[model samples]
Target: MDTELGYSIIPLAILGGAIRVSTPFLFVSLGEALTERSGRINLGLEGTLVFGAMSGYAVAYLTNSPWLGVGAAMICGALFGLIHGVICSLPRVNDIAVGIAMMILGMGLAFYFGKPYVQPVAPDLPAIGFGWWSDIPQVRAALEVNVLFLIGAVLAVVLWWMLRSTRIGLILRVVGDSTDAARAMGLRPAVVRTCATAVGGAFAGVGGAYLSLYYPGSWNEGISSGQGLMAVALVIFARWNPLACFGAALLFGGAGALGPVLQSVGISEGYYLFFAAPYVLTLGVLIATSSPTRAMTGAPGELSITK
Candidate 1:
C-alpha cells in the first residue's frame, strides 16, 4: 500500500510542481521570444526579473493588492526594456555588452530598494483549484493552478497565431530577418526592436511578480535563483517559438520540481543531486542545440548570437 501510494503521489506532485513552477519561465521565455523575433536580444531580463520581483512584492505589501503589484512590476520591466533598446540603438553599440551592464544595474537597484520589504507579509495571488472534485488532499493540492499560468498558456497560442497571420508580425519578422530589407521597405528596425524589447521586458517582470506574488510568495534577495538567466538558453532551445517556449518551460519546471517532489514522497537520500537536475538539463539543452558551423535551426538571422 505504501509503495503504491508513493507511486501515485510522485506523478501528482510533479504535475503540480510543473504547473506552479513553470509560470515564471513561461512568461520570461515568451517575452524573450518576442524580442528575439524582432531582431534584438535583451539579456538584462535577469535584472528586470529580479527587480520586478522586488517591486512587485514591495507594492503588494504597501498597496495591499497583489494585482497592483503585478502591474507595477510590468511597468518597471517595460522601462528597463526600453532603456536597453534605446542604448543598443546607438551606432557601434553592442547589445550584449549593454545588456550585461543593465543586468548589474537592475540587480543593484533591486537589492538597494528591496531591503525593507524582506520580512513583510504580502497578499498572495489566488489560485484556481481544479481538483475541487477530488477526495484526495494531494490531488487537490496538485491541481491548484495559478491564473497567470493559464493566461500564459493562452498567450502562447495567441502569439503563435499572431506571428504567422498578422501584418504586424510580418513586419517584425522581416525586421529580424534583415535590417537592410526593412530599411528598403520604409520600416525602422531600431524602432521596432526597441518596442519589442520593451514589451518583452514587461513579460519578464510579470514572471518575477509570479515568483513573489504567488509561489514561494515573498520578497528576498535570492528569490530568482538564476531562472532569469536560464530563460535565455530556453529561448534558444525553443528555436524562438512562443509555443515551444511554453513546452520547454514546463519541461524545465518539471526538472526543477524533481528534488522537492522526491522528498515529499520520502525519497530524500540524494536530495542535493536531484536539485541539480534543472541545471544539468539546461546544460544538455545548450550542448545539443549549439553548433560551431551553423546557426540554430530557426534563429532570427539578424540576431548577433547567430552571427
Candidate 2:
C-alpha cells in the first residue's frame, strides 16, 4: 500500500514540477523562435537571462511589486537585443559574434548591478492553487501552479494563431525565407529583424523574471542554469514553431523534475545521476533529430547565413 501510494504521488509531483520548472523554458524558447523566424539568432540570451534575473529581483525588492520587476527586466532585455541588432545590421557583421559579445556584456552588467540584491529579499510572484481537489498534502503542494504558467500557455496559443494569420507574421516569414524576396517587396530586412530580436529579448526577460521571482524565489549568482542556451536548441527542435516550443519546454521540464520526484518518494539512491537527466535528454534529443541528408525542416532560410 505504501509503495502503491508512492508511485501515485511521484508522477503527480513530477507533473507539478514540470509546469513550474518549464516556465522559463517556454518563454525563452518562444522568444528564440521569434528571433530565428526573423532570420536571426541570438546566442547571448544566456546573458539576457542573467541580467533579467538580476534586474527583476532588484526591482521587485525596491518597488514591492513583482510585475514591475518583470517590466524592468523586459526593458533591459530589449535594450540588449537592440544592441545586438544594431551590431548585426552592419555590413559584414557576424550575428553569432555580435550575440556572443552581447551576452558577455549583459552578464557583466548584471553582475555589477545584481551584487546588491543578492542579500535582499524580493516580493514573490503570486501562484494559483489547482490542488484544492486533492486531499493529500504532498499532492496539494506539488499542484500549486504559478500564474505565469497559465499566462505562458495562453501566449503559446496566441503566438501560434498570430504567426499563421497575421501580416507581421507574413513579413517575418518572408524575411527569414528569402532576403532577396524581402528586398523585392521593398521590405527592410534589417529593421524587421531588429524588431523581432528586441521582442524576443523581452520574452526572455519574462522568463528570467519567473526564475528569480518564483522558483528558487531569490536573487543569486547562478539563477538561469543555462535555460537561455537550452532555449536555442529548443527552438531548433520545435522547428521554429511557437506552439511546439511549449511542448518542448514541458518535456525539458519533465526531465529536470525527475530527480526531485524520485528523491521525494524516498528513492534517494542514484538520484544524483538523475539530476543530470535534463542535460542528457537535451543531448539525446539533438542527436535523434540530427540528419545530414535532409535540411532542418521549417528552418528559416536566412538562418544559415548567420555564420
Candidate 3:
C-alpha cells in the first residue's frame, strides 16, 4: 500500500491505458472535427457510434474479417449521417434535438439487433511493434502500439494540411464561416454541410469498429459507454483540430485506464472516480477554453450551435 508505488507506475500505466482506450475517441473526435469545420454539427454521432459498434462486431463475427466489418460500419455510419444531414437541412427542425432522437434510435437499434449477438467474438486488429527499439521490457510493452494509432497521427497531419493548403478545405472553411460568403463565392452551403456530416459519420463508424475489433472484440449491451458523446466534448476541447484530438484522446485513454491500473496495484478505493476522470477532464477543459467574457470563437459561423 505504498503511495509511491502508484506514482512510480503512473508512466507505464498511462502509456498502456492510452493505447487501449484512445481508439474510439480518436475516431469520434476526428469525425466531429470534420463535421464542425463544415459549419454543421451532427449531434446524432452518438447514435451513429453505438450503431456502428454493434454493426461492426456483428459483421466481423459473421464474416471472420475485422476489416470488412470496419468497412461495413463506415457505410452504415455514412448512411446515418446522410439521413441526419437531410433532416437537419429542413427549415424548422433543430439539429440538436434531432441528434438526441437519433441517439435513442441508434441505441435501440443496436440493442435490438445486438440481442441476437450477445457476447459474440469478432476478429481482432493487428498491432504495430515499435517495441523492437526499446530494450526495457516495460517500455517495449507500453510502446507496443496499434497501427490505427499511427493512422490517427498521420490523419491529423493530413487533415491539418488539408485545411490549411487545399482548395476543398478552404471551401469548407469558408462555408462554415459564413453561408452568405459561401453563396457569394458560388458555393453551396447545404451540399458542403451534408458531405461533412457524411464524412463525420464514417469516422464515428470506424470508432465503433475499433471498439468491437480491437479493444474488446465482442458484442454486448455495455460495449460502449458514452464514447460518442464524449467525443463531441473532446472536439471542442481540441479546438476543432484533428491533431489536437489525437493528443486529447490519449489523455482521455490514460484517464480511462486509471481504475484498472489502480486495481492492478491492489488499490480499489474510488474506482468509480477514476472511471469518471475522462468526463471530468473533458468538462474542465471545456470550461477553461470556453469563456463567455470573450467572444466564443473558432467554430464555424454557419454552425447552429455556435450561433
RMSD of each: 2.1, 2.1, 2.8
Which has the higher TM-score value, candidate number 1 or candidate number 2? Answer: 1
**Candidate 3 error regions (>4 Å):** 1-7, 133-140, 287-295
lDDT of 1: 0.91
Candidate 3, residues 134-240, lDDT tens digits: the string is 56666666777777677777887898889889998999899889989999999988888888888889989988888877877677777788889988888878888
Candidate 3 C-alpha error for residue 223, in Å: 1.1
Which candidate gets the maximum TM-score versus the true structure? 1
Give per-model TM-scores.
Answer: 0.95, 0.94, 0.91
Please write out the lDDT profile of model 1 over residues 45-109, one tens digit for every residue.
99999999999999999999999999999999999999999999999999999989988898899
Scored against the true structure, residue 206 in model 3 reaches a CA lDDT of: 85
Lowest-sum lDDT 10-residue window in model 2: 1-10
Ranking by TM-score: 1, 2, 3
Mind sharing the TM-score for model 2? 0.94
Deviation (Å) of 140 in candidate 2: 1.7
For residues 80-107, write the lDDT of model 2, one tens digit per residue.
Answer: 8888887889999988888888888888
lDDT of each: 0.91, 0.87, 0.84
